[model samples]
Target chain A: MPRLDWEIYEMIERNPFFKHIGFELVNSSEEEILLKLSIKTDLLNTNKTLHGGVHASMLDTVQSIALRSLYQCPVTAMNLDVHYFAPANTGHLFARAKLLQKGYKMAVLEAEIIDENTTLIAKGTGTYKIVRNA
Target chain B: MKLPVTRSTFFEYLGFNSTKTDTFHLDLPLQAILLQDDGTVHPGVFSTMLDISMGATASLETNSFATTIHLNVSFFDLSPKENYHAKTNIVNIEGKVITAEGIVYGQDGAVAAKAIGMFKASPIKQ
Candidate 1:
């Protein structure tokens, strides 16, 4: 792992929201990144299943992490599209993100959330704007 | 509208509060626990807030439980802020399917994010 990668990892580890959600970095590389979250009582929705927001949150984080792994500069999320496939009520959930397009001032990424059984729970794609420091 | 009695634990965890109005409006007080590394509010925070508020709107409109089928959100700003407010309204309802739109405002009242979502409404059991 490069020094920048370690920096990005440390940054993620220090994020308060990341800690609040109890997300763990399962794997990371320039090619892709994976994050895991264990379903807890506090993460459930009115349906007693994992909240759709959790899926969106995790997908957003994974894609942003994937982007930062490739480019160390600061980036901000510009857009996100999420599709929910099925409900997740138990066990751990995994999210994997891959960069789809890296542009001069913007980047696009896609991610999928799956259960331990590899059942797809949700899918998302995001566009982020690269900040050049105004 | 008769809302579901079951409390959404995740929504509580996010610390969102609804206004007294009949519409689906929510406010999230800025907390250190919701900030990103750069001190700006996390994008996930916006998405989660919008998702819940918008879905809640759809549910309230139909008087049934709602599940998100698809959600699209656009972020216009992510500057460090004090708090956020989100409001949602039903766009259309056809049978069991509902479409809604929501907007999130930053502390300064600027548009922070916009979202549109589709939800499947399931009749709440008596």
Candidate 2:
């Protein structure tokens, strides 16, 4: 796709684990990016349903990556807040991550995970502490 | 037909009101939600789920009561924007701290996210 960026695409494409996770860079700009995942049973929980921990880990990852896209520094997730509405039970999910705001020592980012039906699965905000090696 | 109450049946001993029809149960196959323009899920949701699993796993080995002091999650990539599954199993059970690991799988059965967290348990306070 013309909208896809080579840098991130190459990074994800190269990672063995990333490839197994079934996520690839769909598109990217300077401080924003999109990720996609295919839904399946292995991701489900003992309840014979999808688990919430899955979403939490993901939002944290994208938010950090969204920041790394511009600034090359070690940013760690200091705090995370997530909210779930309904359930993300089927199909692929589409996520859009953008730089909500940035500070001198930390940054705030937001993410949304939507199912194939465009239903909202979960939403979250995170604060990443910027470290040295900048 | 009989009382199903027991020391281990917390969910049931507590008298959870889940109808038999409510068979839907699930966990996060990823770390957190994606916050792209299209939409995304939140990490807090996963944290909550992790807490639930951790609490349950801990209760199994614990004596009476327990509380979670702190939980730390090291997230690598965004949980897939697509769909996936999740599995959580207790990793270790210690004296005061209960440690557990939950792994989320993406479309390809790969680890979408790996989380190691801790929960504190104790006997019922007298």
Q: For candidate 1, list the clashing residue pairs, or say none.
A: none
iRMS per model in Å: 1.3, 10.7
The CA lDDT at B2 in model 1 is 30
lDDT of the candidates, in the order given = 0.86, 0.54
TM-scores, one per candidate: 0.93, 0.52
Question: Against the true structure, what is every candidate's RMSD?
Answer: 2.4, 12.9
Q: Which candidate is the best by lDDT?
A: 1
Model 1 chain B: worst 10 consecutive residues (lDDT sum): B1-10
Best candidate (score: DockQ): 1
User: Which digits, one per residue and each the tens of the lDDT, describe model 1 over residues A1-134?
Assistant: 12336778788878999999999998775445779999998998888888888888999898887777777777889999999999998899999987789898999988999999999999999999887663
How does model 2 score on DockQ?
A: 0.09
Distance from true position, residue B116, model 1, in Å? 0.2
Top-TM-score candidate index: 1
